[model samples]
Structure formats: C-alpha cells, structure tokens
Target: MARLRTLFTALTLSSLTHAYIAPISTPSTHIANNDDDDNSDTPLPLIIWHGLGDNYAADGLASVASLAETVNPGTLTYIIRLDDTASGDRSATFFGNITLQIEQVCEELAAHPILSTAPAVDALGFSQGGQLLRGYIERCNFPPVRSLVTFGSQHNGISEFQSCSATDWLCKGAQGILRSNTWSSFVQSRLVPAQYFRDPTQMEAYLEHSNFLADINNERVLKNQTYKKNLEKLERFVMYTFEDDTTVIPKETGWFSEVNGTEVTLLRDRAIYKEDWLGLRTLDEKGALKFEVTGGGHMTLDGELLAKVFSENYGVYGRPFDGQKETDYPREKEL
Candidate 1:
C-alpha cells in the first residue's frame, strides 16, 4: 500500500506538470456553458501569466490552465514569460520586452477573426506576473483590460521572504530558494513604486515617473494633478490569494493601512492575500472580488478544488482536464 501511494504521488505530480507544459496557440472560439445567456461574441480567451519562482514549464499558470481547460474546453490560454524559464540569465530588456508582449497579445487577439469581438480577454497573473501586469496597466497605457485576476501575487511589494520565522507555516516547505535573502532583494528592488508611477501624490499616477523617491502622498504631485483618469476601465477584478503564502506575508509586504490622526482621504491600501481583498464587496476593481483558499502550497493549486469553485460560483462546467482526475491534483484530500 505504501508503494502504491508513492507511485500515485509521482504520477500525479508528473501529470500536473505535463498539463502545464503544453504549447500555447492563438485564441479560439469557445461557447460559455450558459449557451442561452448570450452568444453574441466568442468567449474571451483566458491568459495565464507565470510567477517569479517558476517559469512556464513548471509553475502555477500551467496548473491553473489545465484546470480551466477541463472546466471550459477550447478556452484560449497563453503563457507570457518576461525572463527565460530554464536559463536564469536576466533579460537585459525584460521590462521593455514585456511591454511589447502586452501589445502583441492584444494585437493577436484583435487580429484573430474568431476572437475579434467585445468579449473581454481576461488576465490571471501569478506572483511577479501580477505586479508586472499592474505596471503595464499603470504605465504602458495598454488597451483597456476587461477583467483581471491574481493569485498569490504581490500587488504592492514583497519583503516577507527575508523575515521568515521558523514558526511560520511556510518555513519548512520554503527552505531553499525562497528563503534566500538575495531573492528577496531582487524582488524588492523591482517593486520600487517609481518603476510604475511617478506622481508622488497619486499612487496610480506615480506609475508615470520612472525613478523618483517620494512619499505616497507627495504634496507637489497631488496639487499638480487632481482626478486622475484610469488608464483602462477595468470591468471585473478578482484577487485569489493563498493563505500562509510565504512569498509575500501581510505586514512587511508593503501593503499599507490607514494612519492614525492623518487627514489623508485616500485610504492607505494594505495588501493581503488575494482572497481577503476579494471578499470585501460583491465585486469592486480595487482589489475586489477576493476569493480565498487555505493551505494550497505556492506551487500547486489543486484542480479539483478550483473545479468545484467554478461549478458553484460561475456555473461553469467544472471537471478534470488532460485525463488527470481532479482528485489527483490535491496534495491533501481535505484541502
């Protein structure tokens, strides 16, 4: 029985990886489960962006994409990698190339005859991918994003890896690469507020300024501009976060809360796991529509569990894809 269990574990992980390794192609026409609802346009393809620790080959994007395909067949999905996955060499032009990639994705979708409709192409970015998307939305002025979802992503900035305590739930599992102070420094440097917005006053506006170091509430920038317009009107925004996520813990993670005895009208927005942010309202784009799932590790998102979610919430056909049963995806049966 022990041997059998070991074999199952190995097979399950292998299958999960294989599902994520499949190649990406152009957007395809897919009918929503609610066929009677409205078929005016093809369902917008779902794009899955990989996180920092893992690449397209072995990451959460592939795992989620596998689940999505099973629940909704023919759903279009793509993996956008700013850095090379296998080779750790930094791309000299990672940021610029990423901007180009965003344009290319939109262009590809618009040019596709089957997918060139109002159906909003949604994006789900994991970890740094989420932050990168935020940078794009705030700075590059890419076309309007219909909907956005992020999983275990550090929307603000991540600094908790450097402070991992032995008591923390992630201590044991996050022993190697994640515990590295160097990795933390690398992510921290990338998340400097100036990278996205420049205006010290407008947190979103600061996205324009490339290399300025100023407070979030810069007096000069605030007086300089008022009522800043959103780059792209976001229709739906979802934050799906993992509890006990080691990569970006709550306190040191750069998420801000309201300051006492301060006249600042804009609430000090502190970042939380995507779920807590989503649970606030029926759904608002300011980190709204938060959904929470406890105990799923940073790398593996159980397909069976997400399938259940899709079935219950979205009323979509939630099932296993790629011949791997949903039961096989969960590291723990109860989770």
Candidate 2:
C-alpha cells in the first residue's frame, strides 16, 4: 500500500509540472495601450506571472495583455517570463532553480525602465506563478506591489501531487529523482516543484528540507521579518480557489492550506495567520487579505470570470478597470 501511494505521488507531481503548456504565437511583444494611451493613462502599471507549463507567448496570455488595455484603456501590462523563448520558458517551469529564477526576476524588474521608478504596481499570478510572485514580494520588492490577485495557486504547498500516467517516462524520471529523497540538495535545487513540495505529513522533513515554500511562507524557525513587512504594504491580496480543482491536490492550497497532514485546518485558525507570518494576519486585519471562491477545475477560468477578476483587481488607485479616474472611484469599493 505504501509503495502504491508513493508511485501515485511521483506520477502526479511529474504530470503537474508539465501540464498547462498552452499554444503560443508571438510571446515576447509588449502590447501597447490603446493609441490614445499615454503616461497619464494609468496611475499604476500591471505585472503578471503565469503558472507552470505555460509560456509568455501563449495566445491566452497575449489576449490577457490585450484585454488589460481594453479594460483599462491605457494600462501597461508586463508578463514576467523566466526565459527568452516560449519553449525555454515552458522548460523553465519543470527545471531550473526556483530561488535563482525569483532572484533573476527581481533583477529584471529592478532594471525595467518604467517599473524601477513606478510607485507601485498591481500583480496577477496563476497557479505556481502566484507563489513565485509572493516569493518576489518577500525577497525583494523594489517596485512594491499595491495589489495582488492569484488564481488557483498552491500558496501553502502541496502534499498530494497531481495526476500523471504511470507509464510516462517523464513521470518515471521524476519518481526516480524524488522517491528516494525529495529532501536531498540536488532535488531541492533542480526540481522546481520539489522546491515547494511541502508534505504536511512529514512536518520536520518539510521544514528542514523545503527550499522555497518554507522560506517564502516563513514557516522556518528563523524568520525574515522583511518578508512580513514587504507583504503588509499591499493594499489588497486577493486569492481565488477553484472549487472543483483536480490539478492541485487538496485544492485548498490556493486559499492557503486545505489540510494539515490529514486534518483540515482553516487559514484563520492556523499559526501562519494567527501569528502574522508573511503578514497574512496583518493583511487580514486591514481587510486586505481576501479569500474568494470560483467554480470549475484549475485554470478553467471563463471569459466573464476573467473580466470580473481583472476589472475588479487590476487598475489604478485600487479601482476596477472601468474607465473611472482614481479620485472618481468609490471608497467603499475597496471592501
């Protein structure tokens, strides 16, 4: 029985790393705002990070960029990509060191011509990308985030891996690498998902061996207070969980952790929130931490939901993407 469970875990994690690879066109071109969009088009720019198996060039992402412009008219949109090419970026989702990738992201954002000087930017993250952006915020938020919205992200971490075929070579390879020791330095440094693979069942192992989630989630004994400080500055941190999500085991990882080991512990009741780890408690206190729910499986967002999500979260002065000026936006809307 134990062996069967291990095999299942290995295949699931393997496929999850490779799922979501979308079709792409031109992934690198930055969509300009509407012709009339200029410096005064928006008070804040927007940044996005896609989940694993996805490339910046995906048609869906480009449409998202175009949609941002239509919704906000002149909003600037930049989707963070780890690699220069679509294939490379997709490959990055499975390989490469997550810490290095995030550090590289920090440097890239700091070097951005406009982003470096912007007062703040609104951010949107998808799946694993959501946690990565949270890492960015904790590690180095040079251009701090005013608002952050994430969809179907494993924010807390995953114990049960996603589904993959038992016969897949790739899945078999992942089992070979992870089954013996997911805690080994090689696996932690190499496998992207392994970095955040927090098995609540093995609490000590997760805390001691987890390379990414532990640090970013501030679950380690030695905490980085800056992570808390930086995150607290956000005007709002919105999280959306897909109710029928099968891609992320125990899907509640999106709203933090759905369970601790085999026990279900709500976020508000967890120490991570009660103690203000990563400033989640602070954000919640100020009504900045929002827990929202949606229908469908992971990454199954429809047009109306996308429009509502974007329009409500990605605009200047914490306003929706509607054509209203910052001052003209209603104060009650922030709630």
Candidate 3:
C-alpha cells in the first residue's frame, strides 16, 4: 500500500512539472477570433519582458505567459528575449547596457507586423525588464502601449538599504551612509538606482549624467518637462511591489512616491504622497492605475496570483478591446 501511495505521489509531481514545462503557444499563429460586434478592435497582444539574467525560456516568463493566457485565452503573447552578453563574455550580464536592451526591445516590436500596426498593446515587465520598458516608452517613437504592468520593478532605482531601522543592522549601516553627504556621494554614484534618485534640493542635476535612468526619466537634458506628459499617455498602469523584497534595497523605491511634487526616498514622513512617477500617479489620480503590495520576495508572484492581479486591476479577463469606457472595469480603492 505504501509503495502504491509513493507511486501516485511521484506521478502527480511529474504531471505538474510537465504542465509547467509545456511550450507556450506561438502568438503569431494562434490569433483569437472575436465574434462580438460590441467590440470594434481585437484585444491587444501582450508582450512580456523578462527579468535580468533571464530569457524567454526562463520559468518565470513561462508562468507569466501562462497567467496572461488565462486572462485572455487565445490572444497572442510575445516574450521579448534580451541578449545579456557583453563582447564575447556571457558572464557580463550584470554589466549589460540598458540603452542596448531598449534598442533590442524596440527592434523586436518593430519587427512584429501585428505589434507595429496595432494602436496599443499590453506589456508585463519583470525586475530590470520593467525599468527597461519605462525607458523604451520614454525614448522610443514606436507604437504606443496602452497598458504596462510591472512586477518587482525598481522605478526610482534600486537601493541597498531600507528606511533607517534601529533593530536591523544592515538598515542602520545604510542609514549612516545615506546621512553622510561624502560617503553617500561616493557610494550613490556606484549603485544603479542612484542615477534616477531625484534629490529634493539638487533636483534633476543630482542624477548621473550617463545613466539610463536619468536619460529616460528626462533628468539629464529636458528634466521633468516631457517626463510627466509621456507617462500620462498610458490607459492603465499597474505596479506590484513585494513586501519582503530585499533585492530592491529600500522597497519603497519600487512603489514610486513623492512629496511636494518631487520624488522622496523615505515614505515614513510625508503628508501628501504620490505613489508613482511612471504615469501611474497620474493614472491613479484619473482612476487608471492600480498598485498592489503583496507578501513575497522580488518578482515572486505565481501564475494564480498574477492572474488575480491582472483580472482585478486591469480587467483583461472579460474586457473588450474597444468601445467600452475605462471606468466600466471594477476599480480598486485608492492606496
């Protein structure tokens, strides 16, 4: 009896693994036929941008694609795979240039006839991919994307410390560094997030002149002029930040909050706070944005949770592509 039970368990596990590993349907070949006359345009195809050090074959991309499939079955889904190699060395993925990644993404989108001609499409970006997409939207003159949903993306830039915590040694050390202008300047320019960290006093001039974050966020040249306008064009903007994400350092950077019309690092002390800058704050003000904070690590939403977020926030499940108002979908209460 024990042997039989073990065999059954093994079979179940094998079946689950096979299900997860199943090849995703080709988006170009399996286009859905919308028969409903109420809807004018077909549902926009979904393009998924994988996280750093990941590819199309990554399990996380598969899971996200699966979740997208569940939301809009038979709809075409494209996975944007990035080449993480620098020169001939594959191990140089961490040093991969952001501008090149954006160019690659633009090239992929332009190569797709369906995506190029369509008015808008939906995008789901994970981790660094999300930040990359934000840059793409800001800089690229290609087709506009209506909805962009990010999972565990560092919008402001990643930090190595959370708020000043008395109990946490790491947080205390980080606080010490941040409080000192000399030490902060030395370390800040070294980190990726520091490039996009808009200081309250220093303003746009504070950003690293050469970093991708500064360029896309319009800090380097135009500075705040075109940044807000470009972000407000999206119909739906959703961001998910994990509660226990140590990878993004101070997780609030992922949340995108600001005080007195300027971005703020700490959310602890604030009166009027805006949750996002990547058009999400404006979308939220206009009832087009949804920001969710779940209990997990970085980019850890499973297929089920992902589906729930998409359905509840964006209403992609039964939503028609055109003719319906954005207000028709069930809107979540403000954060």
Candidate 4:
C-alpha cells in the first residue's frame, strides 16, 4: 500500500507539471454581421481573437456577436482578421497586420462624424490573441479602450513545448522555430520565452539576437509597464481562466520570472491556484482581476451565460463557468 501510494504521488506531480493541454477544436467558417447597415450611436464593437494554431474565422466571432447583441442591442461585431484568407502561412507577418487593425479601429471610432462619441470598445481575445494583444498594447502608445477580456491567455509564457519528447511533431516545430536566430529573436522581442534548448551552441546563437529584441520590442513590456499604463486608462478589465485549460499552466505554487528586461509580471503558483479563476493572473498597478470562475474547463461555456453575454439564444448551452461563486466586475464606481 505504501509503495502504491508513493507511485501515485509521483505520477500526480508528473502530470501536474504537464497539465497545460490544448484542446482540439472544430474550425469554424462563420462570419459575424448585423442585418442593418445603419451604425448605432454607441459603437460598442466586440472584437474576437483566436488562439495559436487557430484561424480567426472560427466560432469566436459568432460567440462574441451573440454576446454583444444580448448585452447591447444592435452592437457592431467586427472580425479582426489575422491575415488575408488568400495568403499563405503568415503567422509571423500577421503581427504588423494585427497592430494595423487596432489602429484602424481606433481611427474609425475617432473619425466617424455621425456616430455619437462613446466608449472605446469591449475586446475579447482567446489564447495567443490575448498574448499578442498584450504585446501590441505594450509596444504601441496606449489606445482608448473600454474593456479588455482574455480567455486562457498564457501571460507568463507557455512551458509545454519544453517537456515534449523529441519524437513529438509539435515539440519539433516549436523547437525548430525557437532555435533559429531570426525566428527566435522576433519571438523573444515580443516578450515570448523560448523553452528547452539542449544544445549550448544553438542557445547561444539565439541569444545573440536577444540584445536587439530587448532593446527594440521588449523594453516597453519588461514588467508589463505598458500594460499597467493602459490598465489605468481602460474602463473595465476581465480575464477568464479555463481551469483545465492546457494552454495555461494551472499550478498551485512557484514564481516564474517576468519577461526578461521588462518588469512584465511574473507568474506565481499561488496566483494560479488561489486565483478566483483558473488561469487569470494579477494585473499591473491600477489594474484588478475583477472576477475569476472555474468549471466548464477550457473553451466551453454555458449556453445561458453565452446568451446573457451575447444577448442571443444558442439553445440550451453548457454553463460558461464552473460552480464557483460570482463577483461583480463593473469598471465604474457609483458616486
């Protein structure tokens, strides 16, 4: 019995470290739109961002559009495209495009002569979209935004690629890209950490480009300074954690370092397990987590919550959050 218990403990810890698991999802071709062309006075645009290995046209846009209609009738839903559908694998190239999209949207809000001036927007991003937006906001001067919400974002950086065995294709591809000086440098500049380099020469080669990355792109986001700055300017902020979200490590202990060079916030184990939500992290000064919920782990949400958020019915859906207690996350304080 003692030996059996010991084996179980060992296995549990092993699995715990490897807990960040991504879900297999069905690719969606749905686009979100309003029936009428007339714009509303309040342009509460809801933008959706998908995760890594995810294409934007997925169910995310539909989900957010549904939510927007529920909360604010006739709200405009915009699909933030990562790349041109007619193009090739443009993962790295899409960074610049993503930045342009933000700027364009902000400009539209500013220049639209007829629309009544309103709040910036309610942006919802999942996985890589969230992390990418973090980089975008950190690099660009803060923009006007009402609410920023992220689901299963790996704010601290993902470690799963490091542990994958040599035989795994995912591990090989990620490793190959990180090992390449050109590729690794661009990735690191965005405050993204590369994991598992068994070869010293290869690691050194990548580090050679680190200086430029740190000076150029990383200087602003090191401690999440930019993120902190924007947090103060924004109206509301929300982060949703999918408890069993494989993309995010749902740990109960340990403190990971912040993005090197920038005070980008570090990830602590307690912050993960004790968090109101499974994967939500602490915000910079002036920023608050607001609320966190566990349960329907990973990308699944209840139909009712979806209807409540999007303001439309999707039949009887799975509960969006687990059985955790709810907390208010309103940005405005009553006078």
Best by TM-score: 2
| Candidate 4, superposed: residue stretches over 4 Å from native | 1-43, 86-118, 139-143, 162-227, 250-288, 307-335
Q: Report residue 292 deviation for candidate 4 (angstroms).
A: 1.2
Quantify all predictions' global Cα lDDT against the true fold: 0.39, 0.75, 0.53, 0.40
lDDT of 2 by residue, 1-335 (tens): 34534453455445543346333322243343332334354747889898877888888788777666765666788989998999888778877789999999999999999998888888989889999999999899978988889988889887755544756766665466565678878778877777888777788988988889999999988889999999999887889887777777667788785476557676877899889888887877666777777777787765556666656666655443332222211121121
- Against the correct fold, how does model 2 do in TM-score? 0.83
Model 1, 1-335: lDDT tens per residue? 34422332332222233123223322344232443244233345665565533456554456567666655555566555444544331221122233444455556545656435434455666654665554444433233445566655554443233333556433333333322321232322332211322212343433333332222122233321110122224544445545455444431121221222222111223232222222222233343333344564443455554564333233212211122111211121222
Worst 10-residue lDDT window, candidate 1: 321-330
Best by lDDT: 2
Give each prediction's root-mean-square deviation over alpha carbons.
12.9, 7.1, 11.7, 12.8
What CA RMSD would candidate 2 show? 7.1
- CA shift at 221, candidate 3, in angstroms? 7.2
lDDT of candidate 3 over 1-335, digit per residue (tens): 34422332332222122112233333433333334443443456787766544556655567667666656555577877555432222111233456665687788788788889876777777775677777777766366767788877776554332343456554454345443431244333333333444434454445544356656654344455455666688776777777776666445555554423334433223321243434444565576566567776665555456655555433233353333223322221221
Task: List TM-score per model, in order.
Answer: 0.51, 0.83, 0.63, 0.53
* Backbone clashes in model 2, listed as residue pairs: 12-162, 27-57
Clash count, predicted structure 3: 1
Sequence-dependent TM-score of model 4: 0.53
Q: Name the candidate, 2 or 4, with the larger TM-score value.
A: 2
State the RMSD for candidate 4.
12.8
